[model samples]
Target: MKQARISTGTQDLPMRWWSDAKTPGAMIGGIVSNAFAAIGSNRQRSILTMLGIGIGVAAFIAIVTLSQGATDSFTSKLGFLAQTITVSRARNATNTSLTLSDRDVKILSQLQHVVAVSPTISDEAEVVFGKKHWSTTLSGVSFSYLQMQNVSIGSGAWWSSEEEQSRRHVVVLGTKVVENIFGQTGIDPIGQTVRIGAQLYHVIGVIEPDSLLGNDGIYVPYTAVYTPSKPNQIAQISIQVDGTDNLDTVQTEIQMRLGQLHHIATDGSGGFDVTEAIGQLKQTQQQLGMLSGFMSSIAVISLIVGGIGIMNIMLVSVTERTREIGLRSALGAPPSAIAVQFLLEALALSIISGGLGLGLGLLMGYGLSSLLNVSFIVNTSSFLIAFGVSTAIGVGFGLYPALRASRLDPIIALRSF
Candidate 1:
């Protein structure tokens, strides 16, 4: 009797293949089918690995986005606080001492492109309101100071030049000072008398809380505390230049005028220090850019690590599926087809993780902005770069493992399992 023969049709086998001249759709379908098959074989592991990539990418995006937003908000607040030229006495200068006098401010006011000049004098002192006492910065400034600093009186009016000339003691309190001294009680602190270092000052206004500068301050009229005969009178002078003119020329002219008034060297380095508010704004912006870049680098590191994790998992996948690869090779599936299938799977994982990460990152950024009372500024460039990098990482790291799978000897790979 002849030995019984068992036959299984090629179609009944676990793996299948198509002809070489197959249509484009069929080729693509085969790639997709293989990727889904791989994922389905180890659904939990694949999902867990992709989750790791998603988390890393999300963290990177959140940190960079938040940092950029915070930097922008901080710079904006600072810009608002200092909107014009700020001339202060430089603590150090070669030759004569750099001091800005009230006379210098008067001269600057008469110059072309000079909008307004405001002088300030400040000292730290204890303020007493009724039985309450608080430590505060006592600032004496001219009427134009409020306009120059863009400060607004939230409740009452600011002190006038007449009040300053008459030496009438009136004070403007910062929001925190008002809150700390008066609490939430319905009693109006305005029109109330407050004593500062043995002098009596009536509360004229309350300024809203400044976002950049911390609170606990009071503003008094410049003339209320100045003595013309006293040499060391004013602390600093703020000058507003014509917004229409060339700022460089205006700054140069202002410096030259200050040099002439103070009798110092005029080679751009005068006795008094002149700080252009616009220059400060630019510097702040540059610093913010650097900070954003640094934070973005940290995010990139996390993404790279996540990509490496994907590569390692893919290598393990190729090893585990060697028998399947060998079976497919035996069925006339080309090595390039095998490689494309694995590469497509890797790309799919990376693209999906990147998208999820970006969404989560944006959500986290908005959440942080809400919590911190700042704005959410999503950088489109950053999002695109992140997604591109993730995809590149997938292709770059996935290639070796995929090629290794495709190059496996069918006979050996089949027998090894």
Candidate 2:
């Protein structure tokens, strides 16, 4: 039986022609049309392959974007802890001694650019309300501590200087403490008696819910919880700089004064250390950046796997359609037309997968963020980069396969099938 010729063009002549490649749009349209036709012929396989690419893209996008959002949220929280100068008791590497005193706070306050100084004494103590007992870290701090730490009272007011001076048994509770003791009653906790350790103290206020610094504790008048024998000793000292720009200078001066007071060498390894809050914030941001980068690297590996899948599928596509290519070439179709058709098919597959993956990724990221109570932030730059890279992968990997189909010998291909 003689084989029938399939001519893309209508005109009959000595040489049969597959198609006229005069218009670029027409050529692209034909390629797209043929690609869809091919996919339609192998519905199950096409769907499975596309799904694989989509899943890979979605996972990559969600993991990378979500991790970046977490890093940003952490960095933002660090900003709330300290903006300028912060002085805390340094642990002795050789020994277990760690102490910062009120005298040291006073000396730090006298330094240039130091606007305010607050001494804090923190100890884990049990609070008793009725029959309920909850263990919480109790902080002894002056009223200035609130302003210095950028914390606000959600209810009632902070302890007054008079209360601190007279050793009054007044306290302020953190949000977690209120939740544990009050259980969402919305009842005023102020004027209520809560026992801390063996001492009964009045709950004068409650702090607003703040995730920054993670110090969900109870605050009391600095003098109220003081041990009379150790009047001036405090666990740490926080110093706020007068201006953001003066933070570096203030931190240096405070460090020098603290080292001199402690009679320690001013070398980097000293008995005490002073940290600028802004410096700590930047360090935290850098660490988060590193984590994000690590996550992106993992995502890249998955994307590469997906790209390889695309290349393998395209190669198979060219092989399966060898007879079609030979027939088209025998009918006078140009090599460029054959190549463009295969390339366009690969491009379409990539675009479809990329779009679906991007949407799924963003949705998954948002869902996870909502579930975890973390922020969901879609990075536009990342989305664009992913799409662009996936498309490029399709073109780059599809090139050899497309060219193979384009360069096939018509007689040889026809004889094989």
Evaluate all candidate structures by whole-model CA lDDT and list the values in order. Answer: 0.75, 0.72
- Model 1 stretches astray by more than 4 angstroms: 1-22, 80-83, 94-98, 210-213, 229-231, 266-270
- Compute the lDDT for candidate 2: 0.72
Evaluated at residue 139, the lDDT of candidate 2 is 83
For candidate 2, give the lDDT of residue 391: 88
Report the lDDT tens digits of candidate 2 across residue range 67-119: 87787776655454555565655665342454566567667778877777777
Give the lDDT of residue 387 in candidate 1.
88
Q: Give the distance in Å from residue 224's predicted Cα in candidate 1 to where it truly belongs.
A: 1.4
Model 1 alpha-carbon miss at residue 315, Å:
0.6
- In the range 44-161, model 1's lDDT, one tens digit per residue, is 7778777766876787788777877787777666654344777776667665544556677788888777777888887897888777788988888888777777666788889887
TM-score, one value per model = 0.88, 0.86
